[model samples]
Target chain A: MTSESDRSRRDVLILGAATALVGAGLAGPAAAELKTVVYNNSGGASADAARAAWGGLMRDRASSNLLVTAPASVARLKAMIQARNVEWDVAELVSQEHKQAIRESMLQKLDLSVIDLSHTPDDCKDEYSVVYALYSTAMAYSSKIAAAKRPGSWAEFWDVAKFPGRRALRNHPVDNLEFALLADGVPKDKIYPIDFDRAFASLDRIKKHIAVWWRDGSQPAQMLIDGEVDFTSGWHGRFFALAQKGETGFGVQWNQAMLKRSWVGVPQGAKNPREAMQLISFMIDPTASAKYAEGIGYICCDARANNHLPENVRPWVMSNPAIAELTVSANEQWWLDNGELAQRKWNDWIVT
Target chain B: MVRRWFWIPGLGFLVLFFLLPVGAFLLQSVLDPGPTFMHFERLFEGRAFWVSLGNTFRISITVTLICAVIGFLIALRIATLQRPYANALLVLIVMTVWISLLVRNYAWMVLLGREGIISTSLVALGIFERKTSLLFNEAAVVLGMVHVLIPYMIIPTYAAVQAIDPALLRACDSLGARPAQVFSRVLLPLSLPGLATGCLLVFTLSLGFYVTPAILGGRGQTTLTMLMEIEVNEQLNWGFAAAHAAVLIAITAVLFFAYRSKFGMDRLWGQEL
Candidate 1:
């Protein structure tokens, strides 16, 4: 009887060990799979587009698996990083914010070997971050006003007497300061380490003329569409989306459009780093990239993607001499250094 | 004993959802990378932060005073009506309460915007020269808030006014007291608890309002809630955002206690305010 009891105890111990081994086996692949969490600035529409772009790559059975999720806001994602519980595997961040995140050491160094760069433009491919998408902040004016030779550049956009209608600008300091400096005759390539005093002085000149200071990409577009304002600062995609909806008598001037890049970053301490890189690689496919650009009304960073684009929209999507002059690359480092101060000063100035 | 077990699930739910989240959020305010007062110090240093703080208090006080006075009168009028009329009026007040706050705020926005009904009417009536944009001003913010908050004020006032004994009014009149005197001496005093309660409710709610201020008062107007929102949403300054939220919650608690003590509100059962 004592031998039988001893045998039962042995059996229990063996069963426990077997369960532990099976549990570890189930968890191992998920652990090995590189987990990438991406923070998308756009709402549901963009989230859907990103998922579609990544769906095929993730569907194929591979050792490295992809995981995609978007935080409700950039702030929540930043909070996670700040807390040192960096759950985000990857994030789609704005140009100005990308600089801020890098300065804070919340991001991981990009490994080119993991990312497929075959379709990436020479200018866009970089050691730190690859420019994921290109969009413009251009002057959008009413069609009625467009007939009146509406403002062609930032200087003209700020000239109340010349443009002669209610104008609106973004509420953000980053783009607004650039627009102000440009109006003050600062060259597009030299709009960095922004002359804050000069920019604010210039901004003050047209402050009263601005009936609205838009807070979102959609606002400036909506303002022009509804005739709430005659001229406003707008993103190309927003206006493009508006144009697609109907014959909205709104047209854009690309002459002095501020070109900005939206970048994707892999956060440090990601659950699945390899999968994140693979997903990032899959997202840059020229054909898939072009399809996304057309669907979303923004240009992809992949120059080869331009070939797949429609003939009519090709010029708008690709980098050319004309497009280059119209675009201004924001100095991420300058903004990183000055963003907090600029924001504080902007709030004080607006309130006063 | 059987009924006691039924409460276990509800107790668990509260512990899991409301209590746990709030406790965690409160913990985040002070106990950051390390326990520090840095967030609060930063908040106090900025003039914008101080100004917004003052604005929040000032607006909430004014709104609460206006709501209480107006809500009390309406409640009194409804309470004095004939049974059928009072019953119908009660239904209307309840319906207003039932309507979503977002829808109400939107309705008020249409009434107040530059191209909205009010501006259009004023222009047609030759009250103003050009269409004035009321879309981003202090007046617009207050107007939006009062509309959304009036129902909260009215319901509580109605209950208080309804509960006032009719015999006391008759007694005052029999003793040669004027209507005004009777109101000042008895009716108003009796309703003080309710009035204080409603004011407290409106004041606390208006303190943290976001959408009304954002849509109606767009720029050059912000409250603590808006500041917290910007920090979390745009700036991604969660430490600052958490501090702001913590301060707002603390202020709300103080206001709650102040209201309770002032009117002996703690004596009443099932009176949230």
Candidate 2:
């Protein structure tokens, strides 16, 4: 009986080992045969939209599988590049981070031939990256407030006597510094290389009147709709999305909006650089860009995408001539140089 | 020898997954880009770090103390209950822990917002002349954290209280001790080790909290974890983040050792050392 049991156990062990070896061998070659381009972006609605817009195109054009990952982190990018284990083939970067990555040599130079930028603005193109979309940090208010009483400008928004309602600003330093400078009557062109002393002084004047300093991207609009605050600084795209859905409880004021670019780039040492470049090219195709813009309520940099958009959506797009004329482009180069010190100062200042 | 071999899998998992990664990350504090104390020096020099550290300790202590008082009373009640009833109540308490932390925080958000149920009811009841948002403040953060952590406090205390011999209490009563006197003298002392363990667990967990404070709190509520997040995510300063983590780990270790020395390690497992 013992010998019979032993013989069966030996046969089972040998069969199991053979199966494992065969599985490993198949996985090695199969993985090599299939090309996958990993695209990491700020997840949520944008990621979903990108997958819908370009995932199929990437598969058809590049013959590569598209993998998506969440909430882009520059620190992770740095760590991966430093370790020589880059995981993302294509990654999205905010304007300041785009500049910072270039400075640190963490991004690969774009093959402009593969990624056409003929319709893209000159300002949107760079040696290592291209601005794919534009979003604005603008003031939004509850629709319950009358138009006459609305604080139209940053200066007006700061005037507690005129507006006479609860207010919330973003807890971060980036847009708040610019807003403070504008509120202090600094011209839009003169806002860069920020005058910190003047800006903080302006912030001090209105700090006590502010009801809340919001952190999350969703907080400002939610606060507005819920009537937690009558006015808040929020991203324009959030309010635009709500408006598109016919939810008019919140109204966005595009006047003096801080226009920020969202960039796409290939990271250094990407496994499939050519496929990553192809994916970028696919993302900026007019039809795909329009669909992505309509889905997320953010305007793509390519002006031709405007032709594909519905007439009603054009006014909401930041690139429309009328809206573009009124907005200010944030100086990302200045932020790239001084972001760390600015953040430290902002953290100290907010608590105090 | 056969039993000793059984430890290999568990010990190997801890060493490979926990110890190696944590050790390497912490080592980056001093060794990254070369051996230097600049990260620590920078951390000490920053005023925000100190402010956040103070907020972290203050919030943790408050949560721990509140949990201890409330947890002990609940535990005492459960200890005296019939077996099935006690088990049912214990299951209910543990069930709350199974709910997503994000869901709980969002529920609190709805309850505490300006036009939320709490604010509207309070205004209608004439408790306040105007509706006020109770969210995005220190109180909301404490409340959210206490809700999540109370189970940790109750479970350990219940075990300790259940381990108490009923004869000892009866003996004390026969010796002419009052109800309050029995509690203060006998029950409290016997349950001290369990209470200590619960406090340590809750306090350490509270110190590392990120979501509760971030979701429910305003500008003034930044904690050590939030500061570390900003460093790692926004500033891309890994070495500085490593330094912050190292400090947090050191403080936790010290508190643990202090607890271990006072209570003896076996009390952690509901036994006398």
Candidate 3:
């Protein structure tokens, strides 16, 4: 019985190795013909928008295949880089993830000559990454509430007695801490290196008032549309998408909006770094950026893209000077340093 | 010789696909970067870890108890019914399991939301003064979990109930025992093993629940799995996440062994040990 089991195990091992070899053999020949640049980004409508914007452009212009992957993850990036098996040529990093990636040396420095960022805003450009799209965690309200009773700012949002309604906030520390600080009367510029004590104190006041602590990006806008919530802190693009669909029951308040940048960077040890840079350059081209923005409500950081945008799209986008002025950029560096602590505290606070 | 060969493939699959990766990942809790208990140390230091751990056990126990009670009743009813009726009822219970868990959770969200059917109907019928959201609470999370996990409970309990000898039940009934007494003495004891198996299944599944709680539950429903996700995805602290996973694995292993010792392995396969 022992001999039989040992022979069976050896046979199983041989079968596995043969299968793996066959699989690799099939993939190797196809991969050698055309250079593939895997661009990993947050999937769903955004991925679709990206494909619509540059799928043809990457193939036609760069003579490379654009293989888009889903739900961009910094953890996956770290693993890939650590294992010395980098799969993604270009990866989209959400908020402070780029900073964390850069800190860990998980990303390659951008070759500015290949990826032209001169047209991009100075604040949006980094040595290792560039902000491709601009979005905000902004306040949105249901049209069911009277216009007069609508909360315009964080302070007003906290005043539950005045603007009484079911409210939802994102179930995270990133934007909520800033919102708490702002509601506690911290000036927009002064709202960095956050005082956790003051912020939590402020949050403690409005804690019971918040009906839902929404986890997903789509939840806040959907909640408003469903009348599940009257006021919510949600991504601006979600509300914009709904408005574009002619759903007029919700209105976004841009006042004190937490302006966030979506970054794209080449992972360190990527196979096709040059092609990846070229793809990034193509993505930020004025026409391409404008088309992408139209597909999804998230505007690219390129100021030149504003010229190609239609008049209707201008007021809604972050690139508009009027809207841009009302927004505050979150301190990504601070978040990079203290994210774990903030997460722990936030988790503790919520449960207690 | 053929049976031995069959064992190799299954054993190899488990070793390669499950054990090797999981063992390496769990090892990271101590051995990551260097050998240290820092991750575990930090885990214990945080209130979030303790609270979420408590929440996980509390929710799992609640879900297990609820599933056991409901499942036993349903199984008992089905066992007494005609074969055709019983099969149909069992199929209906099993059908819910086929639906995606996310779809089911979202359905509950629609049903329990502020302007949802139940809320609106309640208000219209004057049962409620106004539409109030029945969602974003521990109750909603439990309801969602119980909905998803009920099938796991019912299937096992039904098997055990159907296996019970009708003659034995008749033997008790003919001894001038009351209907309640017969059930209490014979059927209940006979069903305990199945109910225990169901409870184990439901409880363990509940411990690892992530999506339902995140969607249906509010601030209070943060479970260990949810916390682990934040650690892995948001915090990018694999060592810490591994520590969380290790703790969960340890508890589950302990529970599994206890179950195995109490009810021998054959009981798990519907054998009356």
Docking class of 1: incorrect
Candidate maximizing DockQ: 3
Clashing pairs in 2: none
lDDT of 3 by residue, B1-273 (tens): 677588888899999999999999999999977999999999999888898899889888988988998999988887778765765776677667657789999999999988899999999999999999999888999999999998778877776677677777668778889989888888888878888888888898899999998898877888999999998998988999999999999999999999999876776655443
lDDT of 2 by residue, A207-248 (tens): 988888887787888899899999999887777766777887
| Model with the higher TM-score, candidate 1 or 3 | 3
Better of 2 and 3 by DockQ: 3
Write down the C-alpha DockQ for each prediction. 0.10, 0.22, 0.25
Indicate the residue-level lDDT of A148 in model 3.
97
For candidate 2 chain B, the 10 contiguous residues with the lowest summed lDDT are B264-273
* Cα lDDT of model 1 by residue, A1-352, tens digit: 0111122222222322332243232332244434334434465345655666665566573343344455434565666765777666667777767666676676777777888776677666555556677877888898867576698888988787777888888777878999999999998778777888999999999888887777656677666665667888877877765565574678878877878777777777766676667666766767767666665556567667777776655555535446766677767667766777887787767655
Query: Could you give me the TM-score of model 1 versus the true structure?
Result: 0.81
**What fraction of the true interface does each of the listed models get right, in terms of native contacts kept?**
0.18, 0.37, 0.46
Report the alpha-carbon TM-score of model 3 versus the true structure: 0.92
- Candidate 3's DockQ is 0.25
Q: What C-alpha lDDT, on a 0 to 100 scale, does residue A155 get in candidate 1?
A: 91
DockQ of 2: 0.22
Write model 1 residue lDDT over B161-262, tens digit each, in one string.
666778787788799999889889998888777677677778888998887777666566767777777766777666777888888888898877876677
